[model samples]
Target: MFKEFKEFMMRGNVLDLAVGVVIGSAFTAIVTKVVEGLITPIVSLIVVLTTGKTS
Candidate 1:
């Protein structure tokens, strides 16, 4: 059982998964920043112009 576990950990799939997870995490952060910093403001401005606030 221990040897099987060790082999599973050493497989190429595990290594690829580790690399993918690291890259995905970085890409997610960049996308989150873009949405929050740039896209959200533009969307909010459009909504406000269309709605015409009463207050």
Candidate 2:
């Protein structure tokens, strides 16, 4: 059982999974920032204009 566990940990799939997880986390942060900093402002402006809110 110990040997099987060690083999599983050393496989290429495990390494690929680790890398994918790290990159996905980084990509999520970039997407979140773009949505918050750029897209949200545009949508808010549209909403305000449609609602005729001066403030």
In terms of TM-score, the best-performing candidate is 2
- What candidate 2 gets wrong by more than 4 Å, as runs, is 1-9
Per-model TM-score on C-alpha atoms: 0.69, 0.75
Evaluate all candidate structures by whole-model CA lDDT and list the values in order: 0.92, 0.95
Q: Write the per-residue lDDT of candidate 2 for residues 1-55, one digit (tens) a residue.
A: 9999989989999989999999999999999999999999999899899998856
Q: Candidate 2 — which pairs collide?
A: none
Give the Cα error of residue 15 in candidate 1, in Å: 1.3
Q: Please give the TM-score that candidate 1 achieves against the real structure.
A: 0.69
* lDDT for residue 42 in candidate 2, whole number 0-100: 92
Error of 2 at 3 (Å): 10
